[model samples]
Target: MKNWNQQEVEILKSKGGVIALANPYDNLVTTGVEPWPPAEVVQKLYQSRQTRAFSEEEKEKLQKFNGYYSDFQSIHSEDAITWSVFGTIARAQIEKRNKFISELFQTLDLESEAVESSEIYLWRRIPHPDNLVPSGPEIDFGILTNDTLVLGEAKWKSSLGAAQGKNKDKNQIQLRVEFLQKYAPKLYPGVHNFVVLSVGLNNDVTENYTGKTVKCISTTWGAICCLQSHPHHDELQRYLAWKIKNTKNG
Candidate 1:
């Protein structure tokens, strides 16, 4: 039997979709749009990275492909889903965006009010607060408001990654909570609302980690699709449903 990634690629191809290529990366072929919805936002954030760290290999890979940050064509791309769901919401019209965010917080059972403005950062690198480790975890996506910060870790066909090098004591979510408590204050002072959202196939993603002050919650891609019921999200919803069905069959 073919593995999950193979199956996903085949499914996309069968539906007239194409895998993204390094040379002249085309978002139209990969994600059904010439310019991704979050293109401008991503470019702005990437350009503002003064202290962001990337390994030599990572830098080389990024230089080879402009689409490496989004990577929507990859079969197992969590970034793709993150961009589709949260990014879409962030870029939506003010009323619609506020509604979507309110729904999201409601889904997670967190008390929140819609904000006039917010920022969504994809793959944000937060350095270690006290040099406890060489580097800190790169958050999958973070939604920042005037009074709240929602840090998310999205997974597709995978579990939460193991602890960083030589740091087996804390899992991925724990590390993010550590950043929220220890490091995030410096960046967004007086922000009391700290939430760690785990987006994955199931609620089990939240079973491994707990935070003292940060509230942690898990929701599946399907749930997000349901909440974000816009025409733009139809393709993603269908794709995730297919993956879930196939995964269950296997």
Candidate 2:
């Protein structure tokens, strides 16, 4: 049987009084997963394009919008990394809370790949000055098969606030909502019906503060309340207590 130790580790990180990660599979490259489709492919595709075919005037017009294509090209080919702890520590928090994303992917029949990398930050568009390209996202989770596409955002934060240093406190939930509405039906011609995950929390995450303002999408900034009621609460509690005992003995 596959050890659920790593699974439990993610749970512990989100819980109070539970510290230190459990190495379940003994895998290196902890907390980061690189996505498939290497970057070289993207570079080659960009080179093969016949830029000469377009007039200089047309090229200028396109260059103005190069930010969109540049990012698309880079993401398509770059190695994607998702922080295992930051992305989705408690899969149940997402899968169990939102039946729509769970069923949505099931319908698409795409096997979800769990990546251990920081690239998930990209997918989540964790609020950052440099990451304004994607902004927040209307939808953060998705299933992409050979041809089909289904996308949605999952919200599991404790509360809302001014994440970007702005005095205006924006509900973190709304960031994902606007993302899909802004990009959907336009970025990809075939993609339709975007979805967002609306999570609720009964705890105050802002009680703890850092020097700088943090964005809501940053999984690290997610509220503990989001993880408290999660189905795996008992399992996590058990695992951490056991780990603490073993550590003291050693």
Candidate 3:
């Protein structure tokens, strides 16, 4: 595979940002793949099933299964391209765990003491804090070290939510930190939250973590895309380039 030059990366950062981080259904459409059944169709099907439900157990199972399916579709659809990029990087990290993570941390400008082993886990849908809250928000990506828990939310052509409301309540990142302090003490004692955007023109990606509330650092998908330039990642690089080219042409 040809080496990716700065020019190519810049082009991708500009024209291919949307394609690189497109929703799964949109990705398929961009690539000329067939669209899924419409939202109304799926809703109608679910409603019909609900109208002729079976026993309590069966109904519970149906609802659960439907929810699971919805989540599956969402995960696959919403962040398909972003996941593709991260998934390839994860695979490479598995091969060169220590080196890969060290470089990755540096790329993201993460300062750490020391970690014996690290793990990268994706698609974390943290449970709600209390019964009052029906559902909890999700962490787009996570990196777990021996003592540190780094969670990141990635955005493309969208602004990160700084605060939930004008009243100045905790922001989304702060809420996650609060949850970790309350619930995930044993799992991840230390937490770091970051947000990666497609265009990080004026965004702050610096370390702003303090106390139990970690300030979210903003970065760009293009910066992380640079990590996939290794020879071992040739296949993924080629694939991404090919897709980006197609997307641009279209």
Point to the candidate with the largest TM-score. Answer: 1
What TM-score would each prediction reach against the true structure? 0.67, 0.32, 0.52
Residues 88-207 of candidate 1: C-alpha lDDT, one tens digit per residue:
565556666666666677777877656666676677677764365546777888877667789899987677777553446667877777777887777788677898888887667875
Candidate 2 residue runs with Cα over 4 Å from true position: 1-16, 22-140, 145-167, 198-250
**What TM-score number comes out for model 1?**
0.67
Which lDDT values do the candidates have, in the order given?
0.60, 0.31, 0.44
| Pairs in clash, predicted candidate 1 | none
lDDT of 1 at 69: 33
Of candidates 3 and 1, the better by lDDT: 1
The residue-by-residue lDDT of candidate 2 on 83-102, one tens digit each, is 12223332324444343333
Query: 119, model 1: CA deviation in Å?
Result: 1.6
Error of 3 at 113 (Å): 4.0
Any residue pairs clashing in model 3, and if so which? 24-77
Error of 2 at 221 (Å): 18
